[model samples]
Target: MSEIKKSVFDAMPQDLSDEFFELIAGNDEVKIERIISRGHTSPETGWYDQAQHEWVIVLQGEGEITFADGRIIKLGVGEHINIPAHCKHKVSWTKPDEETVWLAVFYS
Candidate 1:
């Protein structure tokens, strides 16, 4: 059989006006995606209250996540965080000078 190889860092766009999301793989119970951000943040009045649990890691650059309860978590390269299902949170900040690559796994 032939081999299929891919890199999470590939296909980066030059214009980052919007955050980029790419689905790496998925199944019925779990989904994996790669997100690239540059100084991106959720809307001021919006929060992510996901139905599935999410575990995210910062592979490059830095970012901050803010919870509805006023908690802010900072993550840099090689750092990670687990967001429980239905947890309310939003992205507060990200490194503007460089790309903040995130690998996220969402599972039920």
Candidate 2:
């Protein structure tokens, strides 16, 4: 069989006015996605409380995540964080001058 190869940095969007999310791969119990953010943040009154656990890593640039418990986590290039299911969180900040590339994996 032939091999399938793809680069995470390929096809990056130029319009950074809004964050970009693309599904890289997935199955019934897991999903892998590529997210690109540039000065993007969750709504002031919104938080992500997902049913599945999530592990995210910053591939480029940087970002900050704020938890409902008033804790903030900063992720730089090559940095990662694991968020348990039902944990409320929101992205507070991202590099405004450049794109912050993130690789996220969600699983049960």
What TM-score does each of the candidates earn?
Answer: 0.95, 0.96
Q: List the residue pairs that clash in candidate 2.
A: none
Q: What is candidate 1's TM-score against the reference?
A: 0.95
Best by the lDDT measure: 2
lDDT against true structure, model 1: 0.95
Task: Give per-residue CA lDDT, model 2, range 36-70, as digits (tens).
Answer: 99999999997999999999999999999999999
Worst 10 residues of 2 by lDDT: 1-10
Per-model root-mean-square deviation over C-alphas = 1.4, 1.2
